[model samples]
Target chain A: MLKYLFAAFLISICLIVGKALAHYIGFFPGSIYGMLLFAAILASNIFDEAAIGAAIAKIINIMPLVFLPVCVGVIQYGDLLQTSGWKIVAVGMSSTLSVMALVAFICAKILRDERCD
Target chain B: MNAVIEPIIFCICSIAIFFSWLQFHRKFPFALFNPLLLSVISVVLILFLLEIDYSRYMTGGEWISAFIEPGVVALGYPLYKQMHLISRLWRTLIGACCLASLCALTINVLFAKALGIDEWAIRSLATLNITTAIAMETSAEIGGSAALAAVAVMIAGFTGSAFGMLLMSVLKIKNMRAVGLAFGSASHALGAATIARTSMEASAYASTALILCAIVTAIVAPIYIPFLLSL
Candidate 1:
């Protein structure tokens, strides 16, 4: 219990500092900044990995639930979807397919060459 | 329906519905039966049936949404764990992810424009290939609706998880590294998770790609999205 609280506190502090930096820099989201800061701390060994592992695991386990409210906000945009749902779906599917194809082909070619060498 | 308890009820209901769907999903293990997608549909249906205002549901819903930012920050731990792998193949990983991110943004923008999507939706679509949390943040940063961005991300994620492997096999992309990176870069976490069931090596690569592509897109979207919009 105490460990979970400590983990939360550490993450919150990182998030707060990250948001402040984002506000100052006027680019990139604070969450990403916080992510980078947290990673840096881990890399630097400022805290033991075991200390936050369980707490972070618990958080990640429920991560999908966290997006529920925001996704539900889609209900408010019914008009937008009604007007352009198919178009949006088309764009999403095509772009995803294209990107996947591009990355796969490129990696296959490059990595294959490296293996041959 | 009491105003004072409404928010709490909505929050609890959302949690219950999500966990219930999650259990079902675990047992069924079907790709299309995404717990989030199903839960959203269920909640939306209930709200519609009840004639509840979206805002009223949000009053409680925002409590769950509040955790999104922290959850994203917690993603750092997984990324950190993969640092050794990243350090070893940093060059290839970074290069592939950068290309993937830029290509995804540009293609999404072009397709949205061709489909005559509105400008705001185009911005939302710009981050479609990124994971949910980063995609929403990047979308909003670029003057798009975070909600719409979530919708777009779900679409992209679902499509990738469903068809990505088939598409790769059809394309003759058999390399595990390539397969992992492609799915991760294009489909984000959902794609990575789907790929995880097949090969542990590919799963690692997929995870690395997922995290790296997200970072790349978050950095590149702010500049590239606007530039694409202008064109």
Candidate 2:
């Protein structure tokens, strides 16, 4: 129980830093940057890997958990979508496909077959 | 109850829904059919049917948010293991990072213009490819709606995953590096997660894309966005 709380404690710190940094430094996604900060500390030897491994695993298990808050709101605002909603969806989805294709094409064309690896 | 538990409940429902989605993700393996998209759709449908105001859902949200920090911290290990690989692919990763953000930015705006979308929605859409945190900032920086962008980016990733798979088939992007980068750019961390399931090498390549894209998006998106608005 204490271990779980410890893991939660660490995550709270990251969120605080992430939220703060997003407001201040205007850098990467705050939570993500906060993660990067945690990453830096871990990688730099400030934190021990084995000690945190089990706790980290529990935390990672719940990482996908955060997407929930936003998903709920999309429902509340459903009526706001309108005719433009589907269009927005179409453009967003199609652009993703095209962007992927365009990127792959550009990379293949730019680099020789041999050096790509 | 309304004042204290609103955020907590909202959060729990969100995590519960996504957890089920990840389970489905195990079987599909196809980028386009990721369970996250379905999960989002399902959540919307349920909320619509049940007529939940979403505010009530927030009551339990804190229950889930407690994990956000540890999750980010845990990722350090993956980044650490793959740090050397990142050093080698620095140039390629950097290039893909730039190209990815620029393309996502341009396409959303230009397409919005052609479609007659509003100004608030325009800036919100700009950060669709970026992760939620940055999307929030991107929305604020461009004088758009963070709430809109946050929703937009999540949906964009879902749609991007679905359509991205189709494009991959058409383009026949058989190479792992290209495949990984394509996934990383269009989907962000979620894209990388899908790639990781495909193969270890593929995951490694995707991680490089993930790290590079995150850093690059951070530096460039905010700077480029305001200028794009000026134009």
Candidate 3:
């Protein structure tokens, strides 16, 4: 659909702007910066969701697919993984669990006033 | 075959496997055969066995990559949709995110350092808690490998989604809010998806946590990581 393509076009424009801004600002990646910008625009109602509804739907459905290239890019770093795969996995897994426990405990402690039924 | 066409072939193969495996994944619902992970493995194995050069494979890889930025930019829509919920829990969510972000970065960095991991790898590890979209970019921005961070993000999401619920029960955390927050803040989309299967409220809360934690990390990591790495 034209709307789908249009939505992708709009996102591409945002991505360019985001990249340019990041180039100058030297902060987070342009992708995230652009996403925030798009979010702000959408929140402001400048771009009605209905106009781009189809695209938004597809984007949400296949977000993981978009990242496949990045994942596959790991093949280029095979040597690194072969040497330190276990360490990366160990560190990654531990930190994830620590975050889960820490956040769960903190949120529960804070929201203890309202109990779930 | 011409050089230009190799990328086209690569693209077709990668996308074919990805979509086909996705269908298989949905029917089977096995974590080990995650569509993304499986596709990557298939591509890697094919490329290795066939003696395909990384440079040529990237022809198609680069094509799909064009969509990645726009795909992430589209995240704004969901964030916008969840704005109401996000605002309602603003105070509590911010606190949890601050703590989560600080702890995620500090613990991962320090643990990796203790193991004497390369500094670049440690930098990539710092983006572990956020979604792959933000993590890959943040990794590169902070002088780490985007590729490595993507893999790390998937690993974090897979592990967290698989065990997060178990951890919550063991800790006696019955609050769905806490449970969802832990899943999203720690695991990203995969964790959010896992919780979504349990309840709507938890899923909503999980998405908010996922988006909020990502934004916080995107903003906080650059300023904080440089300082942390300096030490």
Candidate 4:
């Protein structure tokens, strides 16, 4: 239980750090930095996972649910979507598929080369 | 008094709906019942029909937002474990993600311009490849609609997960490593999770690609988008 508290405490610190960075950088997503910073701490062994691994996993599992509020904000864009919904979907779908195809093609080529080697 | 009541209602409604959907998802495991998507739909309907304001929904919503950063950071452990495999493909992975980010950003911007989309909406689309938290932040930074960014990211995730595998099979690509990287780069965490059940290595690569792609987008989009706008 103490370790679990520590895990939450550590994450709070990261969030605070992310907020601070936000003040300086115009486009910096402090949260991404927070995760990277925490990951660095974990990678460097500054934070011992044995203390809070299970707790963190359980917290992360509900990560999707956390975004529901933000997703619901889509309701605000009713006018925008009404006018350009299909166009935006077209762009999103095409771009998403484009990235997937490109990444997969590159990975497949690299893997095939590794096989040849 | 209503402030307190509203927040309480938001929490109760969100949690109750999310939990019930999660239970159902566990039993059926169907893609159609994606917990996040369903929760958003249910909550939106509740807010609209009950005449609850978005700000009130945000009161409880703020609690969930508070966890976004830490939750993403917690992913560090699995990523650390997967570091060895990731290192072997580091150069390839980096190259692939960089190109993927470039393509995703560029395509959206071009489409927006051609369609004469509102500049704000275009800004949201610019960072669609990043995680929802970061994407929303980036969208707000560039004067875009944060809500639209979140929605676009979800749409991208659902699209990739629903159609990605079919696309792969059509291409006749049999390697799990490639499959995982494609989904992760395109759809972020949801895609990564979907592929996780297939094989451990694939999931590891997926996680790696997910993190790397987000990092790359965070770094590249600000500089790239402005440059594109100038052009």
Candidate 5:
């Protein structure tokens, strides 16, 4: 129990610092900044991965749960969906598929050639 | 529902519905049966049918939603675990991720424009290829609706998870490394997890791509999206 709390405390601190840094940098969100800072700390060996292992696992496990409300927030945009649903679907499908194909094709060519050479 | 008890009711109901769907997805193991997508649909229908005000439901929903940013921050752990692998393939991985980020942004923006999508929706659409938390925040930062961005990310993730492998087979992308990178870069975590079931090596590559692509897109989308919007 204490371990979980400590891990949460560490992450919260990172988040607060990240938000503060984001206030000045103005490029990305504080959450993302927090993620980077945490990653850097972990990479630098300041804190053992085991310290936060349980907390990280638990948080990630419920990630989809956290996203539910925001997704349901789409209810607020019914008018937008009604007017442009098909266009949104079309753009999303085509772009996602094309990006996948492009990345796969290019990476395959390069990586395979490296193996052959 | 009593006014005092309503929020708790909605919150508990949401969790119950989500867990039920999660179990169902586990049994079926089908992409179309995604727990998150199913849970969202179920909740939306429940609210609509009951004529519950979205705001009222949100009083409880906000409690769960508050964890989203912290959840994203936790993603750092997985990325950190993969640093050794990433460092070995740094050149190829970084180059592919940057290209993937650029490609996804340009295509989404240009296609949306060609389809006559409004600027606001287009901004949300532009960040669809990344993870939800980052995508939502980035979208709002760039004058888009975070809600719409979440919707767009869902669409992208669903499309990739459901059709990614089929598309790869059709396109004849045989290399597993490429497969992993494509799924990670284009589809984010959902696609990566789905592909992870088949090949651990590919999953590793996919996970690396997922984080790298998110970082790349988060940085590039601010400047590049506006330029694409202008054109």
Candidate 6:
């Protein structure tokens, strides 16, 4: 459908612009750069609010699908996981918990003030 | 050319991808096991076992990757709707980001060493609270284990939500924004996705979480790693 094509076309442009900016900035991932690009396009009135809205809708709808390629990458590296099963899980779980708790504590302290007035 | 005869394989792989993702959506979803991680690993193994090189595999995966463009492009809508929330909380966001990044990084370093884990192991453990891909890259950049980083990100999501909610109840925290940001920053995309599933407000927090986490990590990793390594 034309909608699909429009979606694809816009994404390609954004991604290209994103990749370019990321290259120039010398840090941050290209995709993150693209998100910034989309934000710029939205803010600058270069892309229609409606069109970008429609595109964003499609992207979120299909997010689960988009992750397909990387899912396979995990499987490819299964052996490393299998061999180091306990160690990876142990370390992964501990770090995840500690970091998550720490971040949560900071957020609760800093952002939880209910003072957005 | 022998290379030209690869669409047949690409076609088959795409179907596998479609199904695996579909199964992922129905079962574990993002809140549980990140199916994308599984899908990528499986595809890579398939290609390696079948003697298909990266180019050919990408030829197959690229067809699927086509969707990634539209998906990324389409992310603007939620962002658009959530613009108000972003504007009102910009200042607090800055403070929260800095605090979260420092506390997260410091606790990770100290506790990891206290456990007597190796530096490489700790390094891998360090970046796991981010999304798998970013975690992987963070892992690679610091010469840590990328898979370990992925697991770390997942663990953060799981425990962040479970304990984060419990702690909020005990602490009598009612500020939705803080709850969302906490879950998002610590848990990254997975936590964000979880909020998206639960409520629009939560989703906004998650979006902020994603942006803030990225900002903080990009800032913190460089400074933190050197300090930790030196110690």
Top-DockQ structure, candidate number: 1
* lDDT tens readout by residue for model 4, B42-142: 88888899897888789988776666666666666556665676677777888888988898899889877888887778988777766676677667766
Candidate 2 local distance difference test against the native: 0.66
Writing each residue's lDDT as its tens digit, candidate 6 over B54-134 gives 555666566665555345444544445556767787777766766666666666766666666677767776766665545
Question: How would you class the docking of model 2?
Answer: medium
lDDT of 4 by residue, A14-108 (tens): 76787687768645666766776677777787767677778777777766777777788888888999999887888888888888888898789
Cα lDDT tens digits for candidate 5, B1-231: 587698788889999999999889879988788888899899999999999888988999998888888877888887887898787888899999999999999999998899888998899879899888889888988999887898898888889999999999999999999999999999998899889898988898899998999989989999999999887
What is candidate 1's lDDT per residue for B14-91, written digit by digit as tens?
A: 999999999999899887888888999999999999999988899999999999899889989889988987988888
lDDT of each: 0.89, 0.66, 0.84, 0.79, 0.88, 0.62
For every candidate, C-alpha RMSD to the true structure in Å: 1.7, 3.8, 2.0, 2.3, 2.0, 4.2
Q: Quick one: how many clashes does candidate 3 have?
A: 0
Q: What is the interface RMSD of each candidate, in Å?
A: 1.0, 3.3, 1.4, 1.9, 1.2, 4.0
| Candidate 2, A11-105: lDDT as tens digits | 67876877788789765556666767776766677656667768776655545556455544556555557657887787778667766776676
DockQ scores for all predicted structures: 0.82, 0.50, 0.74, 0.66, 0.78, 0.45
**Model 1 interface CAPRI class:** high
Pairs that clash in candidate 4:
none
lDDT of 3 at A91: 90
Interface RMSD against the true structure, candidate 3 = 1.4
Positional deviation of residue A110's Cα in model 5 after best superposition, in angstroms:
1.7
The per-residue C-alpha lDDT of model 6 at residue B149 equals 61
Worst 10 residues of 2 chain A by lDDT: A108-117
Could you arrange the candidates by TM-score from highest to lowest?
Answer: 1, 5, 3, 4, 2, 6
Better of 3 and 5 by lDDT: 5
Error of 3 at A21 (Å): 3.2
Q: By DockQ thresholds, what CAPRI class is model 3? A: medium
